[model samples]
Target: MASKVIHALYNDDDILMLAVKKVKAAKHHIEEVYCPFPVHGLDKAMGLAPTRIAITAFIYGCIGLAVATVMMNFIMIQDWPQDIGGKPSFSYLENMPAFVPIMFELTVFFAAHLMVITFYMRSKLWPFKQAENPDVRTTDDLFLMEIEIHDNEEELLALLADTGAVEINISEK
Candidate 1:
């Protein structure tokens, strides 16, 4: 059986919340939600788990720090010893202050750049990729609720109507 998406449109946040509450109370499966702007507590209302992007970013930042430390230590101490400006570079522990700038830069660079890449990759977004937005209006002034249905379109439509949906349409995919 092919999956169907019923799109419900809401103009205001209150109406949207009410609709979401009612749909959730009815135990109907909501496939996705589209909003013009982020709605506070919507993720909790939908029972969605928190994103792990922060943890991923932290790990990537640590990796960057490790890379920067090893590279600097090898270059300054082991590989090519440079005694620039009369600052001894026998070991990073000897003059930890000197490596602070490079460490900070690498940490920021790795965390920001790699976290963004991870987020995009996990979301299946890439360069030159067209986003799959069903309704253009949903990006502006509309909130959409996509409900997946196995059968009983009439029942779903009635539920949506009872929830005060401004507009509703069935998606064929």
Candidate 2:
């Protein structure tokens, strides 16, 4: 099934932001926006919910910490206890200082790596996946806003034109 959509092209980020706000105020649903660079506050203007990746990173870091602790304890304390530098390795608490660096490294490693994987999965961006952007110019110096039409094509066209869109195109998706 092909659905109709309006692609409004903007030459500047400021114009795009204003257009987004106006369209949102007029109660028109914007399907997506593509920009050559990141536009600050655009997410809020689009009424998107805040991302939860931070919480997931924290959880992954904790898991990494726990794994490192357990692995070190089992290796140094129970598996083959060795007295290096005259410090007995029979207890984990006494040998805790030596494991600080490993714990910190593992925590950061897990947090960063897992966060990227989580973000990719959540965004449905798999390996070799095709891009969904409608305009190639959006990857260069243009900003493209996509709005789905719902029986008000003329009204949307007029509104988009008034919002300072340089070029407006209608197509089926």
Candidate 3:
């Protein structure tokens, strides 16, 4: 099955932003926007919900800290109580200072790595997945806005033209 969509191309990010706002004001549903670089406040302008990646990062960091604490306690206090440098103490609390670096490193490592994997999976960017970029020029400098046509092609084209779209094309997807 093929669906018809309108592709409006813009040369500047500012123009694209304005176009998006105008289209939204006219109650036309925007499918997606492709840009060469991140546009500040684009997500808010598109009315997208806030991401929860930070929450996941916090959880992963806590798990890493707990694992580090348990591993260090088992190794230093229970498994092999070493009396190094004349410090004859098998207490985990007394040897906590030595484990601070390891704990910090593990926390950061888990947060960073898990966040990356979560991002990739959430974005549907598997290793074998094909790219869904609508226009190649969007990767260079142009910005492309895709809007599905719902029996309002002429009205949408006129609206897009008024919004300063440099070039517009209608295609099936």
TM-score of each: 0.93, 0.98, 0.95
Candidate 2 residues 1-173, lDDT tens each? 89999999999999999999999999999999999999999999999999888899999999999999999999989998998999998699999999999999999999999999998889999999999889999999999999998999999999999999999999999
Error of 3 at 116 (Å): 0.6
Top-lDDT structure, candidate number: 2
| Model 3 spans with C-alpha error above 4 angstroms | none
Best by TM-score: 2
| TM-score ranking of the models | 2, 3, 1
| Local error of candidate 1 at residue 34 (angstroms) | 1.0
Q: For residue 97, what is the lDDT in candidate 3? A: 86
Error in Å for residue 46 of model 1: 1.0
lDDT of each: 0.88, 0.95, 0.93
| Candidate 1 segments exceeding 4 Å error | none
lDDT of 3 by residue, 92-142 (tens): 889888889999999999899989999999998999888899889999999
Clashes of each: 0, 0, 0
Q: List the residue pairs that clash in candidate 3.
A: none
Q: Rank the candidates by lDDT, best first.
A: 2, 3, 1
Point out where model 2 deviates above 4 Å: none
